[model samples]
Target: MNAIAVRAATPADHPRIVDLLTRSWGETVVVGHGVRYDAAELPALLAERRGRLAGLLTYDIGSEGLEVVSIDAVVRHAGVGTALLNAAAELAWAKGLDRLWLITTNDNIDALRFYQRRGMRIEGVTRGGVDASRRLKPGIPLVGDYGIEMHDEITLEMRRPVGSGIAQPG
Candidate 1:
């Protein structure tokens, strides 16, 4: 198996990134925590295996922290997702950000498990958050993975320790 290489995404990668985002979320626009983000226009990290795009992570940096807008791994369980996430954390740390966070739907059990295993903890659960999100991105499905109804939004976060100067795992 080839090693996954993580790097910052450039303008040339935009089209491919948009395509991937569309395939993953039904479009390049994503709604989370009541805000709409055009994922293709955001700063992104890409993971490649043997020159093929294996995973992508788009994020937004704000006064509070860095928010991961979207993350997708084309080939699961192959370290692609982990590589992308680690790169995002390092980027946040380099920018002096103190926290990394993201919002995922409740029905996305895989994402909840994956983020938790990767050192992020559930920060909050907004009841009926997806219902509010659907007003922006109407394509959001009524049901998601594992035959579960998608309703709430789960916010997860990893806080960088004060004075550590590095992003900490867990």
Candidate 2:
């Protein structure tokens, strides 16, 4: 499999990056979800392979810590998603963040498994977070990629030392 490169994204990468996100997030729901975050929302990073953007992530620096606002990846089972995740974790560490976190839908069993495998622990659940998100982004459907109801948002949290060496966690 070809490898994807992870790096900070510049404004030039916006169009293509958004294209990938559009495909990853499902466009109708994205616009209908009624949640519109302009470019000023956060600093973004992108993963590319063979000069094509494969994934993207956007995060904000918050008083509490670094908040990952959105992460979109394509070509799953390839290294793009994991590479983006590893890079984001490093960014959080460099900024003295205590934890790296994100939220997913209540019925997202796959995401739950993926985060756990990456060493993230479930910290809390935002009951009806997706529903609230839909209010902000009217395009978000009542259900997710499949027919699963999108109600609660599960918050996953993970801490990394000043550096996250690839050693397996004990």
What TM-score would every model get versus the actual structure?
A: 0.95, 0.83
Lowest lDDT sum, 10 consecutive residues, model 1, at: 161-170
Candidate achieving the largest lDDT: 1
How do the residues 1-23 of candidate 1 rate in per-residue lDDT, one tens digit apiece?
A: 69999999999999999999999
**Residue-wise C-alpha lDDT for candidate 2, range 1-170, written one tens digit per residue:** 47788999887776776666667665412321224464333588888898887878877666655556677776777767678878888887776777677767777787778778988788788777778787677677787655788888787777765345442221
State in Å the error of residue 78, model 2. 0.5
Global CA lDDT computed for model 1: 0.91
TM-score of 1: 0.95
Q: Please, what is the whole-model Cα lDDT of each candidate in the order they appear?
A: 0.91, 0.69
lDDT of 1 at 132: 96
Model 2 C-alpha RMSD to native: 3.6
